[model samples]
Target: MGRQWRDGRGKLVVRGESGDVTLPLEIASSLRARRRGLLGRDFVEGALLLSPANSVHTFGMRIPIDVAYLDRRLRVISVRTMKPGRLGLPRLRARHVLEAEAGAMEGWRVRSGALVEVDTDGGSDAHDRPDSAGTPSLPS
Candidate 1:
């Protein structure tokens, strides 16, 4: 599989039963109209990355996915997937959450404590802050 982001561009080439699919990073990373899984079985086209201590709502997804919860140092705290239309409760010790397509973590060899680099084209500084709505937020 190809890396999804490079120089602020989304580099995904999704191959499904129909054909190849390509999407820009802007469209791929935004959490607008997306859902969050509480129990770790819900799936969505995209994920709203959350810190371990934050809450989330999952809705409107085409499939289920695995949620990789990370700690303050980007270490894996727990991993689970929520079914569509679920809610992930807050975990006091979680640092971040990664919502990957089903089996993506295993396929990419991603594990707890893996360092994730955020790439941007406009050269914006990496900002880690909660959104005004009180959700864990990351820069796109």
Candidate 2:
């Protein structure tokens, strides 16, 4: 398997019409980390990035979250807010998934066709090869 995410630690800068929005990045490139997700988190300061993920579920989560589906070029495909115990559909074109606190996407201007740029801070990249071995299927 390729290098796993540096424990989902980094930073991201989303270019907005008014200004750039920066947030803490939590990358999930490993099967284990991807499976764990934000299950027990009550609040998220920034966002969680799941590389090679097409869908997500908030089965055991404590708080609602905003989901952003991005294509290979980091362009947003769609943005939706999912409450706890919800499942998101898989986007065929999505190469990565970004999750944040509820209503965070609107504040950051994350929407369809918007380009998201990842600002690397010495951690695994969104394009890094995701670990496939024993990777469980994500909810759709």
Candidate 3:
């Protein structure tokens, strides 16, 4: 069987004004993976990429997180820091959701309008075109 998007375990490179920020990313595309989310994790070193998601909730979380809603073009639509027990409103234009530690988004300059790239092959360079594996660059 082909590798599923849900099985994605790679690095995410956010090319921002400050420079390039590289971090690990766990992609949640499958129903089961999406449902589980980061519920049990006390801390996340990198971030989680939830495909086909427009909303998220931290109902049972232990810490706050920074969430970025991205449109189909991979352009960030909005960014917010949410605390535990809070339910995020759905974004009509969001095709994906990116979640990371509180304040991490700022450090990475991952605000609205910024683009995100993913390297599933453990590469160091960030490409605006499709990845070497032929996966179209993150929605864009």
TM-score top scorer: 3
- Pick the lDDT winner: 3
RMSD of each: 10.5, 7.4, 4.6
lDDT of 3 by residue, 36-138 (tens): 8888788998899888789999998888999999876567899999999999999998878999989999988899888887667776433433355644444
In order of appearance, the predictions have TM-scores of 0.47, 0.80, 0.83
- lDDT (tens digit, per residue) of candidate 1 on 1-140: 11222112322232334443332222122342223332444443433343223444456655666676655544456666666667778767665566666666555444554434332343323433223453325556
Go through the candidates in order and give each one's C-alpha lDDT. Answer: 0.45, 0.77, 0.80
lDDT of 2 by residue, 75-98 (tens): 789999999999899999887899
Error of 1 at 58 (Å): 2.5
User: Candidate 3 has what TM-score?
Assistant: 0.83
Judged by TM-score relative to the true structure, which candidate is superior, 1 or 2? 2
lDDT of predicted model 1: 0.45
lDDT, model 3, position 115: 80
